[model samples]
Target: MSGPWTEWDHLLKVDPDKTLVDGETFEDVCQTGTDAIAVGGTTGMTEEKMATVVEACGKYDVDLYIEPSHSNAVVHDDSLDGYLIPIVFNAGDISWVTGAHKEWARLDDDIDWARTFTEGYIVLNPDSSVAEYTQADCDLDAEEVAAYAEVAEQMFGQDIVYIEYSGMLGDPEKVAAAQNELDDATLFYGGGIHDYDSAHQMAQDADVVVVGDLVHDEGVDAVRRTVEGAKDA
Candidate 1:
């Protein structure tokens, strides 16, 4: 409650288009009526790219956060509000459990951990590249997902519980399932949310609807459309 999460609403996730310039820039992205700006990508995140994006975002008045792909990727600067580290507890491996965190602690800067964002991090049974590459054993039914949510809240003491469908489109049922099963945890949904209607459906139970790829591919107009759709929903 005290750290960087003083307020919350729809978030706009930044995409890494190094060769391109967002006609909007930080001012433009923030102007799209988003509550906050999330800066990070699962892959191809260079320090230079991260710095440029964060610096650009600083010109805007909205609160800013970074989703570090890993410990090395986190570039701590005075402008950042805090970090949103996704803990994939259901990965069925301890590597993402404590091993990954231990590595991050060695960073030169101290982590301004606002809230431990615990995610169900479910990889669809058919399999996505993220699950396969991370070696996540994500063959879970709704029951298992709910159980994971409970543990993530009680055992891990997480303030935010995210139902993530990484690298592919999200399933509304899956996200709603996890949201229903948890208690006192801020619910979040992300992945493949392209339009306002889809964003609305995803936002039904989610406290935050993250739109990343759309911003990367479509541009500011897309961000405005999506944010308007989400707010009106």
Candidate 2:
């Protein structure tokens, strides 16, 4: 059940809550070396705001995808390549795991299942927006993280296993543990990836490295370094 994401090794996740590259537009972000442009955010996500970013990225040749944080934030357009829906596997509240998904399915009848790819997430950033929103349990150790990864791929039939350390950098040991447990699922590591070294190291331990805040903070030249590190790692 690999989706469009399988073709991309490095994804530049543009948070709708944050501004684009200081002076550059979404088009510049796509052309700057990112394998794909993922439009999403944990808070303040709306279809109108997402559409602006999508329309900008659509101007480029890169693949465009949406990671909708809420059902109303989803946008339907020819520019969208697919949707990357994250199911918080370790969320303290059940809504993150299934309730929200049920709402999306019930509200949006036009959802193309073939274009939808679900990532089982273990959100480990206690202070991050997503963790707060979902009330995720961020206290797991390496063994627990590995177990979550196994359940995601084996029992849940997930295509990707995401270890989300949203506002902070992740531990290599934990990432390696999750990678070791997965036999075939793509491992995605995101959070605190701001430079080439971090991106390279994570890329070595995981299948993909998703960068978000970096593009918003340091701009595209810095982002290009990450793209190179992720692919050439």
Candidate 3:
């Protein structure tokens, strides 16, 4: 049950393709008490962009990770604590599930297996860019969601099961459903966690609450509040 993410209660996801709130630097964001910083995006991701964010956050002491969307965007850096490669469980297109991972293995000869792990992702937001890009099936009921979580843990042997509602708030009932099925795989909940209450609500069931887009929109102050919320839960 213990790994790089075992003690993590909050994760601040930084999109390489987007800018942070005006005047707020990576230093500010990194010091927000988030357990880790996840660098990635659904689109416009390249090695240069990934490196930019990684380097900025590298100066800090917090754990840093790359959630590579594709092989082209993967950056090898000593600053990264690990790679949280996402395998979309409900992707309508098979590429999100296996094709992208295969391509990364083929293209990158220097993969650090010791510092890499897979995240079983169930993208459940119909309007999110990740959903559209991966062609994810987002109309599942609570039972269906739990089944995916079960398969991700039991069949795939994933260390983490992520319930992602990319841009909007997700149903707490569905998140709890996924939690009920997992025995050891850490449950991560993300999307629409813009404030303290939303973060607390999701953190109650999810082992780690991931916050993205909030820092870009509201700055580090808002991010600090969510960190408190997640820890408080």
Candidate 4:
């Protein structure tokens, strides 16, 4: 389910030293325009680093969550908001999709999940890490994605259907097309959105525009601009 209308993916590029906000320094940074904070990335997301970042967001009192890289990367602890599991029937993979949820209750810690957001992830960027990691078949076809978007909400009851194109630039045309085809689900668009103009275009069609690397590179204040632009859009 969708937790809030607006959310922030406060993610960094795996390496801690390259991290924009350290584990203990995310409170004030997170308060600027953060309705919620989501942790996790495609790279060096060591469990320790994830814990550190989660704990840091916890310090800020913002809604803290993680988009785990894999099933085993989850921290069965109290510092997280919940998890967003990517489920793509096209890929024929279900581990990161529903498998993680099946065994969540049996973990060491009593995970306080706010909501489990089911997403039909669209991998548009060919050489993206997420594509490689998941071994997703990325053919960048509009009709292909439209069909998936059509079923994601009604069939799977997904909270969101994400039209994502990772790397430096996302495809707005594909995202817009998918947005038009979806049922009663919140459409989320991320990746390749580095500026307000691109973000606004994507935001125009989707329910939410998630710009993570923008904050990491441009700082919280700059991200705030994107957030403001998105809201105004």
- The C-alpha lDDT values of all candidates are 0.70, 0.90, 0.95, 0.65
Model 4, span 89-181: residue lDDT tens: 455355545665576546626444555565678777668777776667778577878788888877777767876677656666777788888
Q: Once model 2 is optimally superposed onto the true structure by TM-score, how far is the C-alpha of residue 106 displaced, in angstroms? A: 1.4
| Stretches > 4 Å off in candidate 2 | none
- Which prediction has the highest lDDT against the true structure? 3
Show the lowest summed lDDT stretch of 10 residues, model 4.
8-17
Model 1, runs deviating above 4 Å: 2-7, 17-22, 113-120, 123-129
Indicate whether candidate 1 or candidate 3 has the larger TM-score.
Answer: 3
* Candidate rank order under lDDT: 3, 2, 1, 4
Q: Write the per-residue lDDT of candidate 1 for residues 112-167, one digit (tens) a residue.
A: 65433434454554465456555666777777777777887777777777666755
Whole-model lDDT, candidate 2? 0.90
Q: Write the per-residue lDDT of candidate 2 for residues 1-233, one digit (tens) a residue.
A: 66666666798899887886557877678887888888999989999999988888888899888999989999988888889899999998889999999999999999988788899999999999899999999999999999999999999999899999998999999999999999889999999998889899999988889999988888998899999889988
- Residue 96 C-alpha lDDT in model 1: 68
TM per prediction: 0.87, 0.97, 0.99, 0.82
| lDDT digits (tens) for residues 101-163 of candidate 3 | 999999999999999999999999999999999999999999999999999999999889999
TM-score for model 1? 0.87
Which has the greatest TM-score? 3
Q: Once all C-alphas are superposed, what RMSD does model 3 give against the true structure?
A: 0.8
Ranking by TM-score: 3, 2, 1, 4
Model 1, 105: alpha-carbon shift in Å?
0.6
